[model samples]
Target: MSDTGRRSRILQAAIADGLLHPQRAPLAAFMDWERVTSNVQHLMHAFPSHLTTLHAFAVKANSLVPVLTRLRELGMGAEVASNGELTAALRAGFAPERIVFDSPAKSWQELRRALELGVSLNIDNFQELERVRQILSETPSTSEIGIRLNPQVGTGGIAAMSTAGVHSKFGVPLDDPGMREQLIAAYLENPWLRRAHTHVGSQGCPLPLIARGVNELVRFADEVNLRAGFAQVRTLDIGGGLPVDFETDAPIAAFDEYVAELHEGASRLFSGDYAIVTEFGRSILAKHGFIAAYVEYTKQVGGRDIAITHAGAQIATRTVFMPEAWPLRIEGFTESGEAKPTGTAVVQDVAGPCCFAGDLVARGRELPRLVPGDIVTLLDTGAYYASNPFAYNSLPVPGVYGVSMAAGARPEFSVVREAQLDLELTAVATE
Candidate 1:
């Protein structure tokens, strides 16, 4: 079945199963578990299985423990950026060895704990490296440590998202005056630095551009190993930036093209010379999930139709604030959850429940004419949308359900997280 048809049926089933009631519960999120599994399988096979690779799912994308636990079960490790995410990965049953600790501003306490836990660490700067040296002096650690290098190949389409630029605060710039030699010397002085990492950017980054940046990393690693007269860098954490297709229901992100481009630009990366690590997040989950919210009211304002929904800055923070960069596709559904026909299209503004005038997910979007009690779903939101809820007006975090439906079978909902009730229940569920 077509992905659109399957999602239509899933939404209808969710409403019939009493998952979203206009009166009781007006908003919720649903993840296509089958689609998530398929995406993970695709990632697992994107590279040759004979190669040593760790496809670490970026926990910041969807930090829900249940989802992280499922990824762990699927043999994907966790790439955590903060203490909370690290704890979530641990609670999800990820072994210390499988988790990769990465952060630009990791606290001293966080560093100490990560060293004690023995997870792999990607040191962000020379200052952090000095701190790690101090910590190692007091206590021996099993963590495979590495330094993040900004190849500074150039910026992607989105300047803000680009992290490999010369002045990007993410990693030590290799192109800066005398910086490249200093980095090589750092590695030579500290033999424990065994990995090299680089992430150009995420969305708006072309695959060729990413491969170009990684090619610089390969050259630097080759020189480092040659200078050391051995393979000092055992692993290459080629950070993930495979962009997702938000405008269409693409079966999966362009993993095939991404690998092909990498081979063309950095062939040695796939020559099995060093172990590989990927930290993909959005591409893995974005296309497989969506947010469903009931339209509370509709009004004709300034000769334009307006739809007030429970989704806004509170859920889709980026879309509401930076719609140009993160525009989302909105589809209208009947109160019964059946997709509204496109013939009823009307240019309208989908407004959220927030008080600010700028809190809009879609402005002048030509969607089916919506009415009170109708549903509006934001597609391609599984990664940052539902998991990164914004607390506005004391709005409770919506429940997240993992939905699965077999062919010719009804949909089943697994509670990834329950909606925030009173003090008796919180936004994040404990399971």
Candidate 2:
């Protein structure tokens, strides 16, 4: 069956099997296991056999325990940015050695935990490096450490998603006066600082800009190694910001294109001198997941059609907050979960259930005329949508299910998370 047909069938079966309740309106985020596995395999194949590459999934994208568990099972590692994410990775059974802790504002307690657990960490600033030094003096432990560098290669389409912008707050600015010399000094001071990391940006970043940023990182590492007269840095953490094609039905991100760009822009990257580490969050899981919501109402205002769905600011926080930067495709379906027939399309705004007027998933998009009780599937939401929900109206968190399908067999679905209940929300406060 075609991709659309197959997805429709899965939704239909989910409804029939009582996995989704139309009354609840917004239900579950569905993950395609097979597609996720294929994407992982494609990334693994892109690297040469001599290079040891760790494709660490950024836990900030989708911190669902089951998702992390599956990624670990696929020989992937975890790149956590917070203590909660580190906890999630550990609970998901990721080995301490396979986890890399990265955060600009990590607390002393968090740093102590990381050191005790023996997970790799990236120091964000010179002050943070001093903190690590203090910790080592007090309680020394074997933990791989690195410094994050900002190549200052220009910003991407979205300024918010740009990590290497002129005024970006992420790694140490490499172009700052005397900053490059200071960074090298830090590495020379601490031989344990054996890794280098750089993440240019994410959704809006261009391929060439990303390549340029990584090339700078490789060059910085090379200089550090040469100046120190020792191969202190053995790994390069080229952070992941591979943009996904939201306008297409492609189930995978452009992994091959990204690798080719890196190879061409930074030929020294694959010299078998250093192992590679990647912190890919969105590109790995974004295309393999989607959100299915119920259209609760339809209205016409000033000659424009509007669909009020259950997937507004709660699930699609970015799309609602910054519509242009995070536009999502909304596919309309009949009340029975079948695809709506092609007809004279109308420009419709898919609004969420939040009280605010800005809680819209899509604005002025042409789609089939939506009606009450219709199903509206939000495409390409696998990464940040459901996993990063905003409790604006205290709406219950939706359930998420991992679905697997084999040829000539029934589709199997397992609950990766359960739908939150009203009482469950208050239970914590009462306790």
Best by lDDT: 1
Cα deviation in Å at residue 299, candidate 2? 1.2
Misplaced by over 4 Å in model 1 are 422-431
Evaluate all candidate structures by whole-model CA lDDT and list the values in order: 0.90, 0.89
Question: Model 2: clashing residue pairs?
Answer: none
Model 2, span 1-431: residue lDDT tens: 87777778778878887777776425678999999999988888877878999989999999999999999999899999999999999999999989999888999999999999999999999999999999999998778889999999999999999999878888899999999999999999899999999999999899999999999999999999999898989999999999988888897678889988989998798998889999999899998888998888888989878899888888999989898899888788776779887586888999989998888888889898888888888888889999888888889889999999998567789988887865655597689
- Tens digits of per-residue lDDT, candidate 1, 272-381, equal 88899999999989998899999999999879899999888999999998899999998888898788889979899999999999999999999989999999999999
Looking at model 1, residue 77 earns an lDDT score of 97
TM-scores across all candidates? 0.97, 0.97
Q: Please state every model's RMSD to the true fold in angstroms.
A: 2.4, 1.9
Clash pairs (backbone) in predicted model 1: none
